[model samples]
Structures are given as C-alpha cells and as structure tokens.
Target: MNIIISNASSDPIYTQIMNQIRQSILSGELQAGDSLPSIRQLAKDLQVSVITTKRAYEELEKEQLIDSVVGKGCFVSGANKDFIREQRMKRLEEKLLEVIQDSKELSMSQQDVIEHLTILFEEDQTS
Candidate 1:
C-alpha cells in the first residue's frame, strides 16, 4: 500500500497514516487479505518512529479495518461497500460540521459559505 504523510499538516502523524490506509482500502486500491508492510519496515521507509506506525496499525485494528496474525503481517479486513460508504459519509459529515462551525463563528453569510464550497467542489471535479 502507498501512503503519503504531510508532516506540516495539522493532523498527527499516526492519524495521517490511518487516513491514508483507510482511503486506499475504501478506493479498492488495497483489497481484503492484502498484507501490509511490517510496522518496522514502514517506519524505516516513512522516516517516522516505530511507535507512530505501531499506533496507526493498532488503531486500524481496533476499528476492524485491518487484522494482524501472529508471525504474519497486518492484512486489510473484508469490508462491504455499504459499510465503507456509511463510514465515509460519517467522516465527511463531521468535517462539514466543523467547517460550518468555523463559518458561523467568523460571521460568514450562508450564501458566501456555500459559494466557497461550490468553488472547492468544482475544482475537485475538474482535477
């Protein structure tokens, strides 16, 4: 699996790892039963501490997104599209709520907030 971490991002390193792996699985880039790299290998490759990678993997395991077997590496868990969509929608809604809160706190008009979102959505469609 390929993952890109943004060190300067507001998110923590382990969260970045978790999000990227989850996205890959959601996008079908990583299928169920596909083994992930060893935590030590990934840590070395990503230039992050072993604790960070371990925490990320552990969180995924706790979420039932991946499983680990003794003597074997971690593998993606079998997940249905419905489950993925439901989870993704939940995450998106949470982020939308955060943005809405920010807009409200800033005293931005509803129309202006919607316009900004529209532009962002349009750019995403083009890209």
Candidate 2:
C-alpha cells in the first residue's frame, strides 16, 4: 500500500496514514488478511516517529479495520460486510455533519445544500 504524508494538510500525520489505509480497505484494494508493514518499519519508511505509526495502527485496530498478531505483523481484519458498511456509513454521516455545520455557519439554506449535493453526486456518477 502507498501512504502519503503531507505537511500541507490540515490533518495530522497519523490521520493521513489512517485515512489512506482505511480508503484502501473500503475500496477493496487491501484484502482481508493482507499483511501490513510493521509499525517500526512503516515509520522508518515514512520518515516519521514510530510512535506516530503505532498510534495510527492502534486507531485502526480500535475501528476493527485491522488486527495485530503477537510476534507477527498487522493484517487487515476479516470484518464482516455489514460491519464495514456500517463503518462507512458512520464516516459519511460525520462528513455530512461537518458540511451541514459549515453551511449553517455560512447561512446557506437546506435546499441549497441538497442541490449542491445532488449536483456533486451526479457529477461523480458520470465521471
């Protein structure tokens, strides 16, 4: 898996790592039981602190997206499809909440938000 870190991003390093890995899993690019790099190795490769990588792995574990085996490396969890779908829905809801908050702060109407979402969704489908 290719993980990119951006100093320009508002998100922290671990968050970026976690997001990329999560995207990979959700997109079926990373299969269940697929091995991930060791925490220390990934840190070295990414040129970040081992603590950062460990924290990312821990967060992923908490989300049930990956599992670590004693004396072995981490692997993608064999999570059920329903669980994965629920997780994805939760993420989408969180993002929508953020958008709603932003729109409210800008004094945008609900109808405007719905229209923007419809346009964006249709554009994505066409692409």
Q: Report lDDT (CA) for all predictions.
A: 0.90, 0.95
Judging by TM-score against the true structure, name the best candidate. Answer: 2
Off by over 4 Å in 1: 121-127
Candidate 2, residues 61-124: lDDT per residue as tens digits? 9999999999999999999858877987999999999999999999999999999999999998
Where is model 2 more than 4 Å wrong at Cα?
94-107, 115-127
lDDT of 1: 0.90
Backbone clashes for every candidate come to 0, 0
lDDT of 2 at 84: 76
Model 1 lDDT per residue over 35-103, tens place: 999999999999999999999999998777899988988999986768867876898999989999999
